[model samples]
Target: MKQGFRLIALLAAIALVAAACGDDTSDTTTAPSNTSTTADAGGTTTTTEEMMTGPTFDIGVTEEPCEGGSPDRGCILLGSVTDQTGTFAAASPGLLAGHELFWARVNASGGIGGLFDVDILDSAIVDNGFDNATHVEAYQGIRDDVLALAESLGTTQSLAALPDYIDDNMVAAPATWWSGWNYPESDAGLILEAGASYCVEAMNAVDFAVSNFPTGAATVGIVHFPGDFGEDYLAGVKLAAAANNLDVVYEQVTLPIALDPSQQGAIDAVLENYADVTFLVMGPNETATIVGTVAATWNASGTDPRPFIGAGPTWNSALLASPAGAAFEGGIYFNSAPWGPWATDTPGHAALRASAEAGGAPASNFVSAGWVEQYPLKATLEAAVAAGDITRAGVVAAANSLGEVDYEGMVETVADYSGNSIITSSVVSAVDAAAPDGLTLLAGPFTGPTAAAHDYTGPCTG
Candidate 1:
C-alpha cells in the first residue's frame, strides 16, 4: 500500500514539474499603445461598452510536473481580478506588470521556501472593466479554479464579491482602502487593503493642510464620488475638519463614477466657496480632469490659489504627463498609502522597479501597487505552508495571521493585517518636474486622532 501511494505521488510530481517548466520566460508585457486619461475616467460615467459576458484575458501560465520533494510540485494558484480594459484600462500597464514580476521572482527562487510556486493562472486574470456586475461575474466564473484572489481592484467591485469570497472559502488582496475593509467584523478575513483607508489618509492630509495654513483658519471642500471609496474620504475629512476647527466650506458627492462628461458643478462649488484647500477622491483619470478643470477655474477667476490634495488611489503618477500635469506641477500634493515611487531608494520599491523595467513594463506607481498586493500574500502563504495547512481555508487563516509586511520599505510603516483592521497612516508626496514619475516625497507615516477614533467595526453602509 505504501509503495502504491509513493508511485502515485511521484507521477503527480512529474506532471507538476512539466506544467511548471513549459512556458516562455519573457517577463515583459507589451504595454498597450494608449494610456488612460482624464477623459477616460470622466467618460466612465458615460461609457458605451456593453458589459462583455466573458473576459478572455489570461496570463497564459503553463507549469511542469516536478520530482518528488521538489519545490515545483506544490502549486499555490492565486488569481487576479483587475481592470484590463474599460474605464481604467490605461492604468493596467503597471497593475498587470507588478503581479507578473512578483510571481516571476517566486518562480525563480525555486518557489516559496523551495517547495511551492504561486501560480497566477493565465485564464484567471479577468478584466472587471471597473463594473460591479462584471467583477462579480468574473469572480463567480473563476471561484472554483483558484485557492484565493491575489488582487481584486475596485472598491465597490471587490465589496460586491465579498459574499462569494466568504462562501467559496477564500479571501482576496483588495487594491483599495475603504474603512469597512479595515474592520475585522466587516471584512471577516476577506478584504485586505494595501494602505491606510481613505478615512485615515484624509484625516492626516487635512491635519497637514491645517498646520501649513499661513494666515486665518483654513476652509475646506471635498469633491468626491458616492461609493464607499468616496464616502470614506468624506467621513475622514469631516472628522478632521471638526477636530481641527476648520470650516467645512463646501462638500458634495455630485459626481457619478460612471461617464459624467463634466464635473463643472463640483468644480464650480469649490471655486464658489473659495475654499483654501480641496480634497479629492476619484480615479486617476477623473482626478486629472477635476484638478485641471478646477485649476483653470481658479486661475481664470483670479482668486487666491487653492492647493489640491488627493487620496492615494484617487490619483496616480501617470497624470503628470497629461495636460493636468500643469495643475499638479503647481502647488498640489497627494497622500499615498504605499511606499515611495518606483525609483525610490527603498530596497523593496527600487528592486520592484528594476524588475518591472527589465520586464518591459513602465516604471510607474501602478506596477508598485501590484507588488504591494503580493507582499501580504507572500507573507501569509509562507506562514501557511510552514503551518501545514495550505488549502483555501488555510490561506485565509494564514492571511489573517499575517502580522506585518514591510514590502521591502515600500510603505513607511509596516502594515498590520492580523487584527483585520487598518494600521491607519500614510506618506505624503508631491508632483515635481524632477522626480521619477513627476512626483517628489513630502512626509508620511502620518497618523490621525480621527482615524484612530473610527476603526470601522461594522460593515460600511455608505
Candidate 2:
C-alpha cells in the first residue's frame, strides 16, 4: 500500500507553474495561491481558505514515542469506560485494547512529556457493561482520580454522564457518533468527537446511492432503532432524501434493537415496497441478523438483489467472518469510518497490529478507532502540560483551543477540532472479501447534507 497524503476532498488546489521566462521578470519561482472558490447559499462565489488539512496515512505516533519505558515520572492517569458484558460487549475487547496499546506507546515514550505515566491496568480501565447506571457508577467511583477520560462508550451512557462531566469541567473522548456534538449551542466541546457523525454518514450514503443508480429517482427505506444514534441517521437520511428529491418509500422508526421475531416482518415491509436502497442503523449483532435475513429471504426460487446501506456501528469483523458475510456479500454497503481497516498498511495500522499480536488482544476495526481516540487526548493534554497547567479546567481550555489532531495518516481527512470540532467527512465503503475487515472504500471524504444543513438546536428526536 502506498503511504502518503491523498487529498480526496474538492479543495481545488491551484498549483502555479512558472515556465522559466527568458526575459527574466524574476529568477525566483512565484508561489501559487492556495485559495479556492466555493459558492455560498446566496448564489455568489467567494474564495475561502481550506478550513481543514488534507488527508494523510502516515501519522505514526504521539509527539513522543516512549521506547524502553520513559524516565521515573510520577503518574498521569487517563481512563476509559467501555462495555464488557452488555449489548456491545462483543466490541469492547478490541476497542479497549486499542486504547490500552495507545497509552502503552505513550508511556514507553516517557509518559505525557515524561512528567507522568498513564496507568491502564490499575484504575484506568472500567467496565460500563453498556448500562447507563453502570456508566454513572464507574465514572462516580473514579472521576476524581483520573486526569480526563480517554473514552466513554455508548450513546445513552455518555448522555447520562454529560451533566456530571460538564459540571466538573472535565473532558472526555466520547465513543458515540451522535450529531448533537455539532450543535453550536451545546457546550459539550469537552467531548472531542472523532470520525464523521451519523448525520453526515447518512447523507453520504444517499449521495453515493443516487450518484450510482441507473435511471429514475430512488426510493429509500429507513429502519432505525429508537435512540439518538439511530435518530441521528434517520434525520440525515430524511434530509438527504428531501434535498435530492428521493422518496422515503418505507420509513419504520421506533424499531427496538433486539433480534425480535418482528424484524423479519420489517424486512418484508421494505422489500415489499421495492425500495431501491435500504438504510440500517443499529449495533453489529442486529445488523448481522437483518442483513442476513434480507439476503436469505430476498430470494425464493429466483434472485432479486437491492442495495443495503448500513451505519458504522453496524460493522464488525466477527460478522464479516461469519455466515452473515457469506449471505450479504455482493449487495451490502457501509459508510467509511474515521480510520481504515486492520488490513490497511499504514504506519498506524502496522503499530496496532504489532501491539495486538504481542498483547494477544482481539484485533478489529474498533481497535483502530481506539487508537484514533487518543489523538485529541494526547494533543490537548500535551498542550496543557506545555502551558504548565494540568488542572481539570486547564485541560478543557487546552482541548477547546485545539483546531486539529493528526490521525496518523490512517484517516483520509484530518479532524478539525475548531468551532464545534465535528469531523463531517466520510467515504462510502462496500463489503469486500479481499479487504481487511471486509470493507472496500468507494466514494467520499464527502461532506454534504451534513449536520450543518440539519436542525440540531435541540435533542435528536428518536
Candidate 3:
C-alpha cells in the first residue's frame, strides 16, 4: 500500500513539473493606436502632416532615502498606499518589498529619463477598520505629490479616491479584485493598471476545479465575503458556471473581513445546507479556519468524497501558518501575479526574493503583484515620457500611442483609448499545492473590447 501511494505521489509530482514547464507562451494582443496629426497646405499645391509628441518627464516610485545622491535626477517618486493597518495588512509588507526592489533596479539603471527618482510615499494608515471616509483621506494625503499611484491594497479606499485622482489626472495601478470596473474598456482611463479582475480569477478557479476534480466536483458551492468585491465575483461565478453548464448547489455571502462566531455560523449554515464543491472568496485566515472546521466535520461524518474544491484570498502564505492549512493539500486556486515563493524563475519573482532577503521582510502573494505592476508602470511611463508629454494629457496620449510595450520579456497588454490608455485582461498564473508550489500560467489578458468613454463605464455607470 505504501509503495503504491509513493508511486501515486511521484506521478503527481511529474505531472505538476510538466504543467509548470509546459508553456511560457505569450498572449498576442493589439492595443488601439493613438495618433496626432498636423497638416499644412500651400496654395492647394502640397499637403504635409506632422505628429507632435509630448514632453519627457520623470516617473516616481516608492524609494529609500540616500544621502549624497544627485538631487533633481533621483527625486522622482513611486507612490504607494497599502492596508498595513487593516485586515489585509498581512500582505502589505510583501507588496512594499516588491515595489522597493523594482524601484532599486530602476534607480540603479540611472533613473527614468535620467531625471526622476522613484520617491517612495507610504500611507500606512489602518483606516480605523476599512471605513470609507478614512480611505478618502489617505488618498488625499498622497495624491498631490507622487507622479503616479502604484499599488493600493484597499479596494474601498481605491474606489472612493479614484474619482478625485482621475479628476486631477493622476494615474493609478490598483489591486482591485472586482471586475465590474472593467468592460466597455473606454472607462476610467486613470485605472491604467489592474491585477487580474475577479471575474477572470473566479473563472480560473472554476476551470481548475472542474478539470482536476472531474467526477468529484459535479456540484458547486460558493462562500463569499460580502461587499461590492465579493458580489461582483459571485455574479461572475454564476455567469461562468452557467456558460460552462456547471451546477451550483450552494451560495452564501458573509462579512467583508471578519469571521466572528455569528459570521462563522452564517458560513456553516450554507456549507451544511448545500454540500458539494465549495468556492471561498475570503481572506487567508478566515479561509483556513473554515476549511479546517468544515473538512474535519465532514471527514468525521464520512461524507464520502468531502467538499471538492474552491479558491480565494485564503490561499496565500498567511493561510499556511494555520495547522489546518494542510487540509488544502491538492486544492486549486487562481493567481493574478506571477511572483510568489513558489515561482523563483521570473525576473519579478527573483527581484522580490532578493528584496525580501535584503529587507528581512516576508514575501507574500501581494508582493508579487507589486513587482509585476512596477514593470508595467515603468514601461508605460517610459514610453509616455519618451513621447515627449509629461502632463496628464501627454501621459494619456503617450499611453494611447503605445503599440505594446515589452517588459521583462513580456508584452504589457492594455486597452488603447483615443487618448486614454487602459490595460485589458492578461493571463493569470494558476496555482496548486505541491512541489515547485504549483504556480502555473493560465489563460489571460486577451485585449477585450474598449468602451467609448471610461467614467461612464463602471458600476456607477457615471
**lDDT (C-alpha) at residue 315 in model 3:** 54
TM-scores for all predictions: 0.80, 0.77, 0.71
Question: Would you list the rank order by lDDT, best first?
Answer: 1, 2, 3
lDDT of each structure? Answer: 0.68, 0.68, 0.53
Superposed model 1: Cα runs more than 4 Å off:
1-73, 213-217, 256-258, 333-336, 412-416, 449-462
TM-score of 1: 0.80
Ranking by TM-score: 1, 2, 3
lDDT of 1 by residue, 1-462 (tens): 000000011111111122255675653332222222223432332222221111111111112332222433445677788887765676666777788798777667776555566767778889898889999999887887776777888888887888888887677888777777766667677776666667777888887777764643478898887788888888888888888888988887765435676777777787688787888877777788788887777689785676778777666766778888888888654645545655566878767867877787766677778877777778776776666456667667777777766667665445456864455666677777676666667776657566667646653345
For each candidate in turn, give its C-alpha RMSD to the true structure in angstroms: 16.2, 17.4, 18.2
**How many residue pairs collide in each prediction?**
30, 7, 29
lDDT for each residue of candidate 2 in 1-462, tens digit (9 for 90 to 100):
111111223344333333465675532222133555555556545443432321111111221222334434444566788887776777777777788888887776766655556655356578898888899888887776666888889887888888888887768887887777655345367777777777777877787778775633378888887778778888888888888898998877534444374477667766688688888887777777777877777665365667677787778867866667776565554544554567665677787778778877765677777887777788887776665456677677777777667766665434456554556567677777766566766765566554347554553543
Error of 2 at 395 (Å): 1.1
